[model samples]
Target chain A: MSLYRPPRTQSSEITPREVYLSRRSFMAGTAAGLAFAASGTALAAPLAATPSAYKVADKLTPKQDVTTYNNFYEFGVNKSDPAANSGDFKPTPWAIEVGGLVAKPQVIDLEKIMTEIPMEERVYRMRCVETWSMVIPWIGFPLSALLDRVEPLGSAKYVAFETVVRPAEMPGQSGFFQPLNWPYVEGLRLDEARHPLTILATGLYGETLPNQNGAPIRLVVPWKYGFKGVKSIVKITLTEKEPPTTWKNSGPSEYGFYANVNPAVDHPRWSQATERRIGEGDGLFGGRRVDTLPFNGYADEVAGLYAGMDLKKFY
Target chain B: MALPALPARLKPASVWALYALGLMPGLYAFYLGIYGGLGADPVREFEHLLGTWALRFLCAGLVITPIRDLLSVNLIAYRRALGLIAFYYVLAHFTVYLTLDRGLILTSILGDILKRPYIMLGMVGLLILIPLALTSNRWSIRRLGSRWNSLHKLAYPLLLAALLHYVLSLKSITLEPAIYIAVVTVLLGYRLVRPKLMERRRARRVTATR
Candidate 1:
C-alpha cells in the first residue's frame, strides 16, 4: 500500500443520518438524466451527494456561524457582508465553462454535472489566513472527477478557477471601488487539483449551499487557506502555466499562490501558529483558541505533495 | 484662509456633551457584541471597532493642532479629552483581544507580541499613549513646564505606530485602510512644510508692521 492513505468510501461519523440513507437511491438515479443541454437555466432542484469516507475527529462547527460568517468578497468585504448582501445573487441556472487544453471542453450545467458525478459528504477543517477555523461537513465530490470529465491535455499543468462576475446581482462587484478585482480567480497545480482531499463543494449540512457560502459550486482544498477555495466558480481553465490568483495579485508579499497552512510560515503581519475556532465555546468568558497544525492537520495525506519544497517559501 | 472670529472658548458643558457623543461607537459596539447583534463573529467585530475608534480619536486629537495653526481654531481645550478617550478605547481593544480573541492564553499572547510586527507595533503605540494619558492633567503641565510639550510630542510616534498597526493587521490593504493611511500621511506631511509657511507668515507680518 502507498504510504499516503487514499480516501476510502466508508462511514465517518460526520455524515448526517438522512443523507446516508439516501446514498443508494441517489446512485441508482444517476442514470436518470444527462441533460447537458439544460445549461443556462436559473432553476436548481434539490441535490443529493453520497457520504464520503473522509472526515475529521473534530465536531462540526455550528451551521449558523458557518453560514453567517464568510469571506466571499464578491458579495462584500466584511465577514457578515456576504450573508447580508448575497440576497440578490442567483446561484441557479448556473453553468461552468470548462476549456483550455482539454479534449472535451463544454459548458457543464450544474444539474448535468450533479447527475454525472457522485457527490460525497466530507468533513474537513477549513483554516482561514486570518487565523480563524471551522470544522464543516461539506457535500461535494473530488475535483478530479470534474477534471476527468474534461480530459485535460498532457500539456495542462495548472487548473485556474474563476468565480462568476454578475455585477448586477453581486453588489460588491457592481460598486466602483471593488475590494477585489472582478471575477476573483484562483489556481492549483494539476496534481493538487487531482488530489482526493481537494473537492468542489456544492452544499453543506445536507442542504443546498447558501449564496453567501458559494452556492452551486466552490473549490475546497483542505490543506490550503480558505481563500484558495474560490467560490461560485463559473470558469475552469486547464493551463500550461501557473495562473495568477486574486490575493497574490492584490498583495504579493502577504498572500502567495500556494497559501498552504503552515504554522511556521508567518504572514508578514500576523502569526499563524494559532487560530480561534468558531462555535467551539459559548464565546462568553473567552474564545476557543487552538494551535494551528501544518497542512491544517491533513499533513499525512498531502504533505508528500510538497515533499522537498520549503513551505515558508511557498507560503 | 480668511475666517470669522470664533468664540474665545467653548463652554465646559459643550465639551462634556461632545465627550458623551464621541464615545457612542465604541460603547455601542460593546453593547452589540454581548447581545449577539454584531453577527456570528462578534468577538472580532468588537475588537476591530475599538481599535478603529482608538485610531480615529487619536487622529481627531492630532487635527486640533493643525486646525489651530492653519484655521485659527483654538479647539485645543477638547484635545485632552480626545486623547484620553483614545487611550480608553485602546485599553478596551487590548482587553477584548486578550479575553475573546486570545482566550487569555499567555503563551499565545506572548508569541503574538514577539513574532507579529502588527501586534508589536500596536503594543508600542499603547505603551506610548499610556504616559501621555497619565500626564494629560493640568498638574503635569504646571510641574513639567516646557518638558510637558516634549513629553506630549510622543503623540507623533504613537500616531505612526497606530496607523502601521491598523494597516498591518489587514490581509490586504483595502480602500478603507488606504484612506486612513492617506489621511495620516497628509497630517504628518503638513508638519514638514509648516516651518516654511510659518517663516513666510513672519516675513509678511514684519513688512506689514514696517
Candidate 2:
C-alpha cells in the first residue's frame, strides 16, 4: 500500500499554493477539451508551439507511420504490436518520480508538468538501431526545462529512466516468453539530459500522443538511437554511476550504453551505413534507402558533448 | 521398411488442394502489403513475411519423409509441391530484397551480399535450391532415374543454409527464430538417423527368416 503512495519531496514548498492551483486549472482547461483518441485516430487539438532550431529540414514521416509503426515492446515485439495491443493502456493520472542524487526530488504530476512547460515543435530525425529512420514533428519542451526544476546535485553523473511495467495492461510484459527484461530502463549522461535537443515529448502531429506512441509523456533524444528515448516513463533517477539499460544488459556487445547514432559503428548484426525511410515508399514497395548521417545529422549541436571519447568504443 | 501405399483417391485432388493452401500465405501477404494493411515499412514487412514462409515451407518439405517413415503417413505425393512452393517463396523473398529494398541497384545488392554474412548465407541457400526447383518435375526425375534421389538430397544442405540465414538476420536472439531452429534440428535429426534404424530393422528380419 505504501508503494502506491506518491513520494514526498523537499521541492513541495517551492510552488506557492495559489500558483499551483491556478496552473492546475489552466492545464485542465486546455487538456479537457482534447479528444483522447485510440490508435490510428486523428489528434484534433493542436498544441501551441514555436519553431525550434533543432528541427530537421527533412520531410516529416507520415503521421500514420509515426503512430502505427512503433517499437514499444512493452506492448509487444512486432512493429505493429504497439498500435494493435495498446488500446487499453491507461496513461492519465500518471506521476513521474524524479529522485536520487537531487536537491529536491519530487513526483511531478503529468498535468502540472504539461502546463508549466511551454511546448515547442521540433522535427527530429529518429534513427532506430535496426537501421530504419523517421523524421517526426514532436511537440514538447526540452528535457533541460524539467531537469532544471528538479535541480540535480553535482555528484549526479548520469540520468536514468524507467518505463512503466503494467503486465495487466501491457500484454507483452505478461506473455510467457517476454522479448525484453521488464521495466525497460535507459540512461543518458547528465550533460545529454540537459542538452536543448533532448525533450520530454508529450505529443506529435498537433495532437496528444497516441497510446501506442507512448501516450501521456515520453523522452525524445534526437541524436541517440530511438531505443534511448524510453516510452511511458514512470521513474527518473539521477545516479553517480551509469544506469543499466535493458538492451545493454540483454546483449552487451550489440547495444552500448552510449547509443549515439554513429553510422561508422555498425550494429553487430547489420550495417548502420544506410537506413530505409519508413514512410518514403509507395503503399506496396517504394521506400528508398539513404546513407545514415553521423550523430543522425545533429553533429554540430551535440557532437562536442562527446569531446575526446572514442565513439566507436562507447557505441 | 516398406513404404505405405497412399490412399487411391488422395492423389490429384489432394495435390491441388494442398498447392492452393500453400499459396494462401503469399496471397495474404500481398493483400496486406498493397492495401495499407501492412504497417509502416511495408516493404520490410513483406520481405520478412516472404522469407519466413520460405523457411517454413522448407521445414515442412523436409519433415514429410520423417513423418512417413515414423508414422506411416504417406504424404510423399505432396512433398514436391511443398518444395516448389518454398522455392517460389525464396524467389519472392529475393525479388523483394533486390527490387523493393535495394531498388535493383546491382552494386549495392552485390556489395551487401558480399559484405553481410546473413545475406551471403541467404544467397547460398537460394543457390542450392535452384537445381532442386528446376528439376522438380517428372521429366527430370524420369531422365535421371536413380541419380534423381541423390541430386534432391541437396534439400538437407539447403535447409541448413536457410535456417542459419534466418538466425543471422535477426536483430537479437528471440524465441521465434530459436523455435524455427529447434524445429529444423529435429527434422534434420530424424532424417539422419532414419536410414540406420531402417538398416537395423532389415538386418533383424533377415536373421529371423534364416
Candidate 3:
C-alpha cells in the first residue's frame, strides 16, 4: 500500500470540506428526523444545475426556510403549520390522471414521470399573493413535456390541476370550517400551461421534495402568484372552458382566474407594491421588502403570452 | 363550584410570580431571535408571539370578573397585574411593528395606520389601553377614585377592537379567531346580566326575612 492514499474521488475532493461536511450532516439529519431542527445553515447544499438562460441571478432562499415556510393549505392555514403537520402525509405511490379533451387520457405513476422526463434545475422567483417572495432552485421537467405526452386536442383551451384531498393526510381539509374547498383547484390557459417556464417540479435543492413543499410532484408557474402553482397534484384536466379555481370560487372579486403577479393590482386587503423576501434578514426586522415585480420578474419571457389582454382586468 | 381565594399574605408573592411568568414568552422569543431559531421570519414570528400573548392576557383579565361572580373565586388582587402585563405586550407588539417591520419609516407607519382598517383598529385598541395602563398604579387609583372604574371600563372596547384587528388581519376567517370572539362575547354577556341577578337575590333574601 502506498504511504499516502489517493483522494477517494475527484468530485468529492473538489467540494469544499465544510460544504461536504454540512451536506453529509443535512442528509444524516434528514434521515434521523432532525431536519427541522437543523436551521438554514446546515441544510444549505451546493446544488448542481446546468446553467440556463431562464435561471434567476438572485441568491437561492435557504433550503430550510423554503421547506418550512410553506402555504400548503391542505396541511394547515399557518405558514409553519404545514411543516409541523405534514409529518405523517404519504406522498409515494402517487399517480396523476391526465384526462378531458386529451387525445390519450392516462393515469401516469409518479415514478414513470420521474424516470421518463429529463429533469433540469431552474431557479425561479416565487412571489406569494400575500406579498412575500423567494428565489427557489426547482428540479423538474417542463409542463409542456407532460402535456405533449398527453397530446392535448384542439378543443383543449385550458388546463386545470387538482390537488389530492385526503382528510386523513391533510388536517386542514378535515377541520369543521374547511379553508377553501377541498382538493384545491387551480388553472392556467393552455398556452401558459405549455410555456417553457411552467414546470412540474419533483425536487428542490438536489433532493426529493419535502411533504410540506408538495412532495412527489407539483406545478411551478413562475409568472403567476405562488398559489397558482398547485401542490400535491393528482389530476390534470384539459378543458374547453375556463376551470373554476378554488380561490376564485371562494372570493370572485378578490381572487381572479388569471392570478398573475401584478404590483399594480393590489389584493383588495393589502398593497402588492412590495414583497418581504424570506431568508434575507434585515437585522431585527424579520425580512426586508423589495418592490414587487411584474410577472414576478419573468415578464420578458411571458409578457408576450398575455398580449392584447388587459392585465389589470384579467388579474 | 366555589374556589378558594389566595391568602392575604401570599398576594404580593403570587403577583410577583405571575409577573415573572408573563415575561417568559417574550424572553423565549428574544432567545429564539438571537439563536436563529424563529423560523424563516424572526421579526414576524416575534411580532405575532407578542400580539398573541397580549390578547391572551387581555382575555385572562376580562375573565376575572366572571370567575368571581360564577365560581366565587376572588382574584381581584391579580387583575391589575394581568392588565399591566397585557399593556406591556401590546406596547412591545406596536414597537416591534414600528421599528422592525416598518424600520421606523414614519411615513409608511402613518400611511399603514391610516389606510389599513386592521392597523387602524389595532391603534385604536392601543389608544384605549394607554389611559388604563397609566391609571394602574395606586396613586392614579386614589386620584381618580370612583372615576377610575369608569375610565377602566374602556377595557371592553379595547378587547373588541383587539379581537376585530386580529380577525381582519388574517386573509380568511378561521376557527381560532372565531373562538376568541365567542369567548369575549360570553364574558361581556355575563358582566351585563350579573348585577341584575344579584339584585334579585338580595330582594328574595329580604322577603324571606319579612
Candidate 4:
C-alpha cells in the first residue's frame, strides 16, 4: 500500500471546532427532520463529522433554503425542480468505481468507504455560475484521501468524474430534449483534484445529503463555481490528457474547463463581478448583491496551484 | 372558425375591462413575489416573472394583427390596449431591474448594458416603446394621421429586440426558450405575407360578387 500521507491542518492553526459547529443538537434534532416530515419527504441519517479548518466568516445559507434550492439537473433544470422531482432517486446500496491509470482500480461500497476515511465539516462559500452564492456546511473528507487510496500512476495527470446515468431514476435524463448530455461529466487537473480545499461531500447541516443536494456523494471545490462540483458521482478515472467537461462542451464560449470563480472574467450573458448572497438579509431584501472575490476568496490557499500559468487563457 | 362580435353598445365597457384584465397576471405575480411564492431568490424570480410577462404581452400584441388577417378574427380594437399593457409591463420590469435587481448600482447596471448583448437588446426595446407609448393616444393619433401608422410600425423592431433579449437571457437554447423563439419568429414572419394574402382575399371577393 502507498504510504504518501497528505498534510493535516494543525489544531492551533485550525478554526476552533466549537466556534464553527454551533447549534449542533438543534440541527441534529428537529429543524431539518421537521421540515422534511412536514413536506412528507424521507430524511437521510445524521452525519457525524469533525469540524475542519476550512470555514468562512459569512453566515450559513439557511438549511431550508440550501436543501430546497438545488441545481441537480439529473432531477431537472429549474432551481426548484430538483427538490420537487428527486423523490424517486435511490442513493442506498451505491458503490463508486475508481479505475483508469490507477495502480489499484477497484469498486468501493459507499458505507465502507465512508467508515474508512475521516470526514470533516467544512463551512465553504459556494459561488454558482449564475452569480449566486451560498455558505454551506458540508461533511466530507479531502479528495486527496480518496486519491491516495486509489494510488494514481505517474502517467495520471487529470482526474475525471462521471455522474451516474439512471434514466429510470433521473427524469431529467429521460426527457426528449435533455438540457445537458447524459452521464453528466466533469474533470479537474490532478493538482486541483488533490488540493486540500477540494472535498468529496456526503452530507450537509449535520445530516446526510438530501437527494436534491446530490444524495450519497458529491464533490465540493470552494474556489470554483458550483457547477464544477459534480453531483451524485459514480465513477472517477485518472487520465494523461485533459478530459472535456460538461459545461465546456455545452457552451464553449461561456463555460471554461477551469470554472474558477473569477469575478474579473465576465460571463457572456451576465457579469461575474458581483454575486447575490442567497438568504442574506431579512424578509423581501433577503438576497443582497455583494462583490465576488477572485478564486472565491480562496486565492490565499490555492492560487499557488496556478502560479506561472495565465488563468485567463487556461480558464 | 368565427369569433362572436361584441355588441356595439357593450364594446366600450368590454374594451376597458380588457385593459384591466390584461394587467391581472403582472399584479398576481407581484403579489406572489411580495408573499414569497417566487422561491428562495425571490428578487430574481420576481424580476424574471415581470420580464417574462412583458414578453408574453408583446407576443399577445403581435398575435393580434395575425389573427385579424389569417383567422378573420377582429381583435383590432384591443390592439391599442395590448400595446399599452405591454409597455406598462415593460416599465414594471425595468423598474424591478434597476431598483431591485441592480439595487440602483449605476456603475454595475451601465457596465451590464454596455457589455451584455441581452441587456442591450432589452434596453433598446424599452427605448423604442417609449415613443410608441407616448403617441398611443387619441390626440397624437388625430394629429399624426397617416404618419402615426408608419411610426407605430416600430412595433416590428421592438418585437425583434425584445425576442432577442428574451432568448439571450437564457444560458443556452434550451427547449422552452427555443420554442418561444420559434413561435415569435412565425408570428413576425406572417406579417410579411399578410399584404399579399389580403390582396388575394379582396380579389376573390370581387370575383365572387361578379
Candidate 5:
C-alpha cells in the first residue's frame, strides 16, 4: 500500500489539543443545556428607578398581581405559597451580624439598617433561574451603603450572606437532605458587591417587606439569578476566599457561584436564550416564549466587571 | 369446537372506538383554555378539567378487569392502553399544579408538603404511579411474569392513595370523592372475594348433579 495519510487529517491538522478543547466545550454546552432545562421562563422587563426616590411606595404592585406570581422554593413551591407560608416567619427583632476580616465589625438591627442607608425605590425585573420573571418596584438601598459601615480589611475578597434558619418555624427545613443548608447562603465578588444594582432590599411595591418576599432584609443582585440574592439575612461575613454557597454545594456544575443570569450561556439542560413570562395573559406573547437578555440586560452597568475574562470557560 | 378468528372489522371496535373518542373532549377543553378559552379562572378551570380527566381515566381503567371477567370479553389489550392514558392525564394534572400553580419552587413545595396532608397524599399518589408507568410494557410483562402481576397489584393501593389525595384536597368532603371511594372499595373487594365465590358455586353445582 502507498504511504498515503487520510486526507481529512494531515500530520498537523487535527491535533490532540484541538480535540480536547472541542470536547471540553461540548461538555460545557451540555451542562448549560441541563441548567436551562431545570429553569427556563420568559425574560422580564426591567423596571425603571422612579425619580421620586421614596423610601416606600403606595402599592409596589397590585393585590391581584401579587398573588399570581413567584418561584422562591426555600419559602415554598406554590407561586402563592411564599405569600402564605412566609407570613409565619417573624421579621421583628431580626439582627444582621457583620464580621470576619472586617475592621468595623458590628451588629445592626433592621431599623438601623434602613436608617443608616437611604432607601430608593427601584422597579427592576426579577428573573428566576427557572425562566419566569416579573417586574417589581423594590424599596431598598444599595449594598455599598451597608459595606461602608462594615469597613472590610485589605484581605477581604468576598462578601457572604446567611439567611435566618428556624426549622421549627420554616417547615421546609424539616428534611435534613435539603440541598441547601438550614439557612440559605449566597456570596459576591468584592467588586460585584460594590455594584450599584446590588440592593439590600426591604420592601416591594411601596409597602413593608412581605414575608414571602424576604421581608426583613434580602439582597437584590439584578444581573444574577434570583438565588444569588439570599433572603432573611442574619449574618454578613467578609472573607479572603469565596464562601460556600447553597446552589454550588448542592450541584456545582448546575449552579455556579457567580450565577449571573446570562441568556447567552445555556444552562446545561435547557436553552437560556428565551423565557416565558407567567400571568400576562395570551395573544402574541401570551403563554409564549421571549428572547433572553445578556446579563439580564444590565450589561451597561455590570459587563465591564468580566471584561478580560472568558465567560464560556469560567461558566 | 371454537370458531376461527374473525376479521379486525367484525371483532367489536365499538368499545375501543368510544374510548378513542373520549380523548377529544379533553383535547377540546385544553384547546379552549389555550385560545382565550376559560374566562376569568383559566388556570383553575384547566386544573379542574385535567383533574377530572385523571379520575375518570383511573375509574375507567379499574372497571376494565371487572367488565372483562364478567362478560368474558378481551379487555387485556385495552387495559394497558387505558392505564397509560390514565397516567398521561394524571401527569398533566400534576404538571399544571407544579409549573402553573406552584411555579416550580422547591423550598415552597417542600413547605406545602410539610403543612398540608392533602398535598402530601397527592405527592404519594404521584410517586406510586412512577413504577407502574415504567413497567407497563410487553417486554417487562414477559420478563417479570408472576412478579409483574404482584407489582401491578399496586394499582389497588394507588387508587386508594389517589382517592385519599382527592378527598383531602377538596375544601369539603363532598359527594364526589365519597362516591369514588365507595365504588373503588367494592371493585377491590370484588377482586378479593371473586375466586372463592366461584369455587364454592362450582362445588355446590357438582354435588347437586351427583
Candidate 6:
C-alpha cells in the first residue's frame, strides 16, 4: 500500500535533524511493525493508497517523561490535573466494544488489541485548542483499518466516538463548569475518518500508554485540536448525520461542529497560527517556535476535501 | 499617654499563621511544576496559577474592611501583611509571565501588553500593588505619618484594577470575578460611608447631653 503523501508547499524545507530522527524511529519501530505484519489479520482492510511522511523524531522523551506528563481533563482545568488526580482511576481489566454499522462488531480486550495491530511510529505535531503544542511519537495504526472492519452503511456520513464514563474514576464529572460531557464525545466526517492522518493510537513515545494519557486506547486526529480526539474510548457509532460532538454542544460558536483544524481561523481568545512547542528544549534558553500549518500541515491531502467550503463560517 | 493602642488584641502571630496557610497553595503549585504537574503547558499553568493567587489575595485584602466593619473582627494587624502578599503574588505572576511565557523579551511583552486589554488590566493591577507593598511596613507608615493613610488608600484603586483584570481575562463575564467585584464594593463602601454615620450619632448624643 502506498503511504499517504501530502503535497508539501515547500518540499525543500526538511531539516537534517528531521531526516535523522525519521530513519531512527522507523528502524526502532520495526519490531512492532513486524509483529503486525505477522498477525495474519486481513479484517476488512481498505485501500490506503496515499503514502505518508509521518516519521518520529529522535529526541522523543522517555517513558518517564511521557507517562508523568499528561493533559487529562478528568481532574480539572489544569493540564497537570490528570497526573495529580489520576491516582484515583483504575484502568485495569479494560475492554473496548467496537460495535456500530460494521460487518464485524466485536468486543476486544486491550491485550489482544495492542498485540493484534501493527504499531507504526509517527511524529505528529499535536496542537491543543488552548494554543500550546508538542511533537509526539505515537505508535498506532490507521483508524481506517479498524473502521473498515465495522463496514459502515452507505448512509453513514459521520462517525461518533465516546469515552468510558465512570464518575468514580473521573472526578471532573462532578464539576459544574465542565466544557465537555463527563464521558466526552467527538466526531468526524466520514471522509475525515478515512483521512490518512487519523489513527487509533495505543501508545506514545514508544511505550504503552499511561492511564493519564488515555491508557487502553484513544484516537489521534492530528489536524483537529487535541479535544477532538476522544480518549479512553469505549464506543463508536456511525450515523447518517453529523454526530453530536461535545465541544460543539457546549459552545457551538466557539467550537464548530466540524472542528477541522485551520490556522487561518483564530480561536476566540487566541490565535491558532502559531503555538508554543512544549518540551522542545530548556525552559529558559531558546524555546522553540513552530508555525502551525493548516490541517496541522496535512493540507496537501485534506485540503482538497474542503476546497469550496468557507472555513471562516465553519470555524 | 495613648497606651500603645493595646495592639488591637489580635496577635501578629495569628496573622503569620494565616499567611503560612495561604502559601500552601502556591507551594503546591511549585511542587506540581517540579513533578511535571504543569504537564505539556507549564507556562500557561504558571501564568494562570500566579494570576489567580494575585487576584485571590487582592480580593482577600479588600475583604479586610468589610469583615472588620460588619463583623467587627478588627483584622487590622493582618491587613498590611495580606496586602503585601497580594503584591508579592502579583509580582511573581508578572515575573513568570514575562520570563517564561514572553521570554522577558521587552519587545514582545510590551506588544502583548499593548495589544491585549486583559494584559493591560493585569499590568495595571500589578503596578498598583507595588506601591502598596513598598509602603506596607511600619517604617513607611511612621515616616509618611498622616500621609501614610492617604497613600495606602490606593488599595481601593488596586482592588478595582485587579477586578478589571479578572473580568477581562475571561472570554465571558464569569460569576466568580463578578462576585469578587461585588464583595470588594461592599467592603470599600463600608469604609467610605460608615465614619459619617458614627460622627452624626456622636453629635446627636452631645446635643442631648447639653
Q: For this target, which candidate reaches the highest TM-score against the unseen true structure?
A: 4
DockQ of each: 0.39, 0.53, 0.40, 0.54, 0.05, 0.20
* Per-residue alpha-carbon lDDT of candidate 1 for residues B59-171, written as tens digits (9 for 90 to 100): 99989978988888777778998999999999999998888888777987898899888899999999999999999999999999999999998998999999999988887
Per-candidate iRMSD: 2.0, 1.6, 2.2, 1.7, 12.7, 4.5
Scored by lDDT, model 4 comes in at 0.85
lDDT agreement with native, every candidate? 0.84, 0.84, 0.83, 0.85, 0.68, 0.69
| Local accuracy of candidate 2 as per-residue lDDT tens digits, A212-296 | 8887789999889999999998999999999999999988998999999998888876788889998886768667899888888
TM-score of 5: 0.57
Higher-scoring candidate on DockQ, 4 or 6: 4
Off by over 4 Å in 6: A1-53, A56-62, A88-116, A175-179, A283-286, B1-42, B77-81, B104-111, B114-117, B127-210
Q: What DockQ score does model 3 reach against the true complex? A: 0.40
lDDT of 4 by residue, A68-176 (tens): 8868888888888888888788899899999999999999898999999988988889999998999898999999999999999999999999998988888888868
Error of 5 at B9 (Å): 21
Residue B116 error, candidate 2, Å: 1.5
Residue-by-residue lDDT tens digits, candidate 3, B1-210: 666667789889999999999978998897888678888878778888899899999999999988887777888889999999999999999999888777887886787788778889999999999999999999999999999999999999999899888877777777778788898889778778989988998999999999
Residue A295 lDDT (model 1): 90
Which candidate comes out best when scored by DockQ?
4
Would you list the rank order by DockQ, best first? 4, 2, 3, 1, 6, 5
Every prediction's TM-score for the first chain?
0.86, 0.86, 0.87, 0.88, 0.77, 0.78
- Badly placed stretches (over 4 Å) of model 1 are A1-46, B1-10
The list of candidate 3 runs beyond 4 A from truth reads A1-22, A25-51, A175-177, A282-286, A308-310
Query: In terms of docking quality, how is candidate 4 classified?
Result: medium
Question: How far does residue A51 in candidate 2 sit from its true spot (Å)?
Answer: 3.6
- Error (Å) of candidate 5 at residue A157 is 0.8
Question: Taking the tens digit of each residue's C-alpha lDDT, what string does model 3 give over A1-315?
Answer: 121123232333233445745757677756554653353333233334443445676767877689889798888888988877887788888999999999999999988777776778777889988778898878888899999999999999999999998999888889687758887999999999999999998878766678888877899998899888899999999999999998888888888999999988877666777787889874344468788888888777888999999988898
